[model samples]
Target chain A: MSRVLSSKVALGGWIISSLALAAVVVLAWASPAWAGTTTPVLRLAAEVAPHDPGAVELLATLEQPREPVSSGRVSLGGVSVSFSVRVEEFSGAPLLALGTAKTDAAGIAMLTYRPTWTGRQAFVATATNEAGTSLGSATTTFIAKSSPQSFAGTVEAVRPDGAIGQAVAGVLLSIVALIWIVLLAVVVRVNLGLGPSRAAESSGLKS
Target chain B: MSKENPSIAEDHACDLGEEVTEPGELADVRASAMRPVLETPRWWWPAVLVLGAIVVLGIVAWVVQVADGLGVAGYNDRAFWSIYEADLVAFIGVSYGGAVVSAILRITKAAWRAPLTRIAEATALVTLPVGMLFIVPHLGSPWKIWELVWPPYWNLSSPILWDFFAVSTYLLATAVFFYLPLIPDLKIAQEWLDPNRPGLRSRACRRIYKALGGNWTGSAPQRRLLHGAIGLVAIMIIPMAVSVHSVLSFAFASSSRAGYLETIFPVYFVVAALYTGVALVVLSIAACRRLWHLEAFIHSRHFVRLGFVMVAFGAVYLYLTFTEYLIDGYSGTSGNAAWVHQVLLGRYWIPFWFYFVAAGVVPIVIMAFRRTRTARGAVVASGLVVFAMWVKRLVIVIPPATEPLVRSPLSAGGVLAGNWGTYHFTWVPISITVAATAAIPLLLLVLFRFVPILPIAEMEELAGPEERAESVAVPGLSSGDGFRPAAALGGRSLAASTSPPSAMGEEGGR
Candidate 1:
């Protein structure tokens, strides 16, 4: 009876240790796949090349890693990549959309940007698949030496010389001035009584 | 005339309870009108003291704000324009009542306007300055206010510059409108001063009255000149008031904000001003009637008629408000739609609903029924209208100012937005606003202490035989003898009472 019990206990311990080892092996094998599936970090790089006097060729490269089992394709293409620029260095400053382009067979997207401002410009590139799932994004900064034209600051006031505005203001101010003059005149006339009082005339006649 | 004979004066005093046989008599009109100026009521001192303390508190709050900065007043970058701006609009907006009652009614020669014009005009005269003073607190640095008017610092194209011009011009016009009809009344009051009184107060009153009255003897030429001047001013003031409020709306309308950039804003503001203006006039009339015991002159009919006018404007305002919301809401623009949604259903829902219920529904319900359209009812409605209008102004100002305009980069398809900022109410602004509100009655109370509450000359002038007969012939309404009560032509009275001579002459001379 003692020999039988010891054999049973040894069998049970062997089974438990084998099952735990197998589970560890499975989890170790699946962990990388799970991480890759959950967070698919794409390699995206944005490059700026000076084109015309005030224009630049914005190039975004969406690099995809090769699979161990190859699908026998030479290039990845047709992914929609968007380009944006932030001229201001402030974190709160908004990123203005430059434009969007599809990747070529070389896995590169290109856009011609005519910058209206010359400053420390930061460029951002984002890639998304056909299903609109974001693949990844990248940012690069460069000094824009020249602007297409004189950069008008964001703050704009109503110009006094705009034709319609000028005309309207003129008319309104004239009317205002006319009203003021008339009001003042009326007040002055009331103060002076305009003419002799009828009571004074009656008193004079009585005298 | 009563001063010539003590016995006759005593007889008039005794006949106070009985209806006077000659209501159109100048002496009787003068006596009734000048009662407030002559006598200081028991309640006056306490009311003044309380109101004055509040005004002092407001001034102290303002001083603290100036010392500490606008942050103490719950102002932030997101809520740059908030309570003080609304107060400015509301205070100025209520002043339009004076224009409506004094200018518009005078132009139309509305006979009932005679008794109410003084209160209306005086209200305008005081409240406009109070409203204009709001700009001081609003600017945060009032010392630089001169830059708004100074030519070198003037931004001609700025709506703020135009606002200052329009408001100052309107204030001038309001002053002229208030003073033009007061000449003959000044003369009447001057005549009432006792020659035997030996005091600086009496002498000062005489001199001031004489200076303001000029050489007016109620003669034909003086009346003609005065009438002509008043008519011109009345006509000019209407458009001036319209421009003032329109320009005021332009300050908001010109902004490229979701809720503010509406074409309907000018007309909307003008109508709101008229609506609130009439409501205030009704309230002032009710207060004067109750306090000074001028029920014989300002009957319940005045309240009802003014209530009707207020409701008419209220109806139009409601329509305009509906139209404003419907158009902006239907357009479905991201910003405007979001703002509208926020106002109707989001964070600002309480104030919006409060305004809708108090201003939009209750007043209409009150005015719709005859039983609820009494002096007390008008007072209730007017009070609600005034408070609700202030709330409406806040709704107009704050929501748009604090709306989130920037789009988040992480948003899918540019749909998701940032959080909307909030304007928290602080004690500083509340104190200042309450003070300004209290200042209205306080200033008016002080004003009436010098000038008659009623326009004595205008009332007597409008009290011709035909007018008096028409007034007297009205069913369920009667007054002291031949005196045509301001509301005689309007409708039936809810509460009417007359002041006897003894009450009128409680303290005849200062």
Candidate 2:
């Protein structure tokens, strides 16, 4: 192939690859269920299960903005959705996440949370798929209660707690510290007399 | 005795030439510049005392603020960053004027810079720390300031983290740059002090100067090294300062806020900083001229020249201001259009108008008109610019904050909020700001007492013979001119010219 044509081909390939990567990110965020819709509505409903009053049933439904799916497993099959259970204290502090769970092929995720705090608590379900693509997102909040005998199902943690992020933050901070230390050292070193003897000091008054 | 001895005072004027042609003449100039340090002024103690009280009050207010929350200073969730953030940017921004002005003049080999360098450098030196202190107050949790440097809490992508890094680096560079030029002057000062002085203060000052001057054999190689180092630093500091303020602007611009999101803001902030910074340098020069009686060294021409520079930046900033608003306003973005309307016609209209007229129009008019371009006029213009610039920063910060996050078209249901959320004026920030203002001159006063306010070595270097011949001949008879050539001739002192002023005038007149 000619150099010019080959270079053009390489450039074209790179552009296509970047676009594909971006598409993947968008698909991962919005899940296949969004299908390029701007707003994906995630309805959250909190209820005390009839059989186990202590276990709060949290439900999240994924759909377009302003479009609510009918009751009982609407057909958002294979679309991934996550539901969060948060406990907020009465003092107005931020919501602390209790647990999270992903939706099954039935377009519904159920989180059974047993709250430790007695005050009003909120259950928020947010859809991450279709998040970065200017596609619509749906976040619904429902205040629920949890007291005694929560279900024995495993709780999936959804809170952002990352050791790598914290470590990165530390390394960034040390750069500033290094700058200060270097500055302080330079000041002290210079002020303590870094150069040769003064002309006047060597030869009295008459320069 | 010279305070009352009219002849001694008259002879001092005779020596007030722009240049020092001979060694003895240079000695006379050095003696005159050092006069303030050697003979403590009667007004010094009183000024220091008042400034000290203001500083103390500021500290007390900050303490109370820490005791109370940032809310005591009128901070709220809606207005998380307010006056203190503006103050941090303003103080740091103004220091750039000093550093850049001094560095540019030095790099360009401007002769007039000799009298102004020390003052400029000292201003930068003092203001950087004060500016840094303001960040503590700007933070909700001042105690967590250490977390900024602790690394683990840092986010490399975060603008705030980079802002911290940039400012700290700039501060270090400024300190180094300030000290480099003072090295030779320190040597001169150390040699001038009498070892036999009895008072502990004088002895201590001497000792300090001696230690500071260490082994500066004014050898050619040493001078070259010092000059080269200063040059390198001077070159480095300009870019460092630009980066510092650019990053600071990023802390705002990187935000999703409508007013801050404009791409023009970084340039706008930088230009505004330069304008205000130059005005501050002019003010400092004028103040030092009057307060230290440095009229001989820093003359009407210095103010006029510095005034021109200030006006130049003022013009650029005014253009930038217009461009910034015009672009945003013209873009027809609902959010930006609302912000522009709010700034021009809404609650913030007062500060905006004041800044527009006072800092924008007034300085250009003053400097442009020859009649009002004297030292006094320039000082007034500079004073207005300084105050107006502060208000401008307020205008920059507050409008965006007060504008409802949810903006609509100006024609829509209230483009601007009927009543904006308040970042009210409280005693805490007021006291702290006043204290910071007071601290600059106070620190300067203390700094000059230790180091000669003039760069003596640089002065000697610039004092070429041709310029000296003119001042020696003219020997103007103004009351402000403390020396008279006629008196010098009558006394026949070795420091004075041998010929009469009339004779020298006739010789030079041809």
Candidate 3:
């Protein structure tokens, strides 16, 4: 013990250990960044004869794939563009959305309204280009006729080792773990014995 | 006719090469320096040949796996990655342990590191390539190995691609680390090689020496440059190793699977590697001792000290295992908790316990006690520590993967779910993995047979003529009477023996 305390040799273990500890703490405490969202606008323009000022075009916009948006005709660009649209709700909750329709080279964006009883419906419009994507619309109150529906899921006979095999995989997992133990033993032994090259040199000089 | 006292051995070491400025009264620094050239041991050559055959067999096995299909070895969608990956990790992680121990010791100036540095560095060099070869079989398409350099697959986002880069970088770094220190040693080996050995080998040696040595005729400037180079490699290596293990751990962690994905996985892997790497080194050193008759060079003290390192890491690993389980289990996620239960108490309990007992507990206990702190104890402890670490690795990989991605097929009542399935290991992969395992030591033997075992210049400087004829002061290892037999730790209680080497390494001068 006296030999080392009295010796003038420099000890650097503390420096490295500290650095590693600090770096680990810094990384661990940090959190992952959240993603951003872009709201895209949909331009809704339709070809309609100018003779009918009150004439509304029946149109619908689906903001999401596999599901259509619900709402009736709303006033857009001085025309009623949306008609009676059934707002279908699946088990998964999807909120009601709205969109605005403006005029373009294509036509004046509009929603045509249709009434089942005598009530209000909602309309939505969506657009996409290089700039980004946007959704806008107005809500029309409405009542609808009752309807019926059904649900479905897949079914199959249970297989122990999966459809292919199970009895064999369990045995193999044990065997592999055993093998890992042996290989790792050899590797660990080898590295620990290899000492510091530079220190060995200096010690050689002192001896 | 006179026998030297234990104090002499204690106070002095066989200097490799240096002008010993001062030696204690009993110092005999030149005892082994001018002794004789070390002959290739008998068992080494035999092992090399035997290992060579195994390697050939492994190659054949790989071919079969390729020709017949990956089905020959154990892999299916359920266990898409199994033994191949675990083996890869166990093998590659060990290489980092070498880098950490050797480079860290060198930078820290540990005196005991002198004899084992070359061996450690060489092990790192040999196993890294074998680790890389593991990727070939991991591939669904072996021919697509080259895709690592192409687009898409080469996308930095992929961990496999990261493995390619990290492994390559580490390989290059370790090789340079090993080769740079060998310049002077190679020069000495060249001088000893007779004409019968051939001039091409000699010329090649001389040229490499010149290029690397670059006028390193033992001058102060050259020595400074060499020291600087060593320092740079040491610093560069720790992070290089961190990168290697972190990327490797990512392969498991990035998977959406619960047990496979953990925030602590990378650090856990690094610790496991450290534990296993030390054990491997201990085994090699013991083999070297038995075969080379260098017990005097590498004795019980060295083994005991390294055992301490293994034990330390083992303890840390156990804690991490607990932390992982507690956090995972307490969360009460059925999939995660069930996986833990399976590992700790299910069918896998045997291997897991074995790992805990042999690799984790026994070594630490043995290393913790002074009476059992002998060289033999160290050897046994190290062997177990390494074996257990591997078990830990395998456990790390399989359980979570086997739990069925969503629900167990057996428990689904009457319906199969998801893309669920399991894989089993076949004959081909086993043969390949074993052969690869055997091939490492075999190839290392061949490499070492050609390279000098010690740094001749350093040894020469440490044991120069000026030292034997005068008295000098060394660093911390030597006290007032260094190795005087009377000053030996005679009859010291077991308590003294079991203490960590750091205490003595830092305070031995007394």
TM-scores for every candidate against the unseen true structure: 0.71, 0.65, 0.61
Q: Pick the winner on DockQ between candidates 2 and 3.
A: 2
Backbone clashes in candidate 1 total 1
The alpha-carbon lDDT assigned to residue B283 of candidate 2 equals: 82
C-alpha RMSD for every candidate: 13.1, 20.7, 28.2
Which regions of candidate 3 are displaced past 4 Å? A1-207, B8-40, B195-214, B408-423, B460-510
Model 3 gets an lDDT of: 0.57
Highest-scoring model, lDDT: 1
Predicted structure with the largest TM-score when compared to the true one: 1
Positional deviation of B75 in candidate 3, in angstroms? 1.2
In CAPRI terms, model 1 is classed as: incorrect
Model 2 C-alpha lDDT per residue in residues A1-207, reported as the tens digit of each score:
699999999999999999999998888666645444234556677777667755667777665444343453334544544555442212233345555455566567777765442223456665554332322234445323232333479755334437996687578567556656755665555443343334443334323
Q: Which ten residues in a row have the lowest lDDT in candidate 1 chain B?
A: B501-510
Two-way DockQ contest, 1 vs 2, winner: 1
What lDDT tens digits, residue by residue, belong to model 2 across residues B24-73?
A: 33234456456666778988999999999999999999988876567678
lDDT tens digits, residues B1-510, model 3? 013334334432222222211222112112221112324455766787888888888889888766645545755435656778888998898877667788987776554565567777888888888878888887846777777667533544456766776677778778777866665555345445443554564566455544444322343433555566677777777877886788899888998887887999989988888878878887776765454434444545667767788788888988998899899988867677777787889856887899889887888888888777767788888777766777777777777666655454566452223332344556777788788778767766666556755444443333333431221233433444332112111111111212111111211211
Output the chain A TM-score of model 2.
0.39
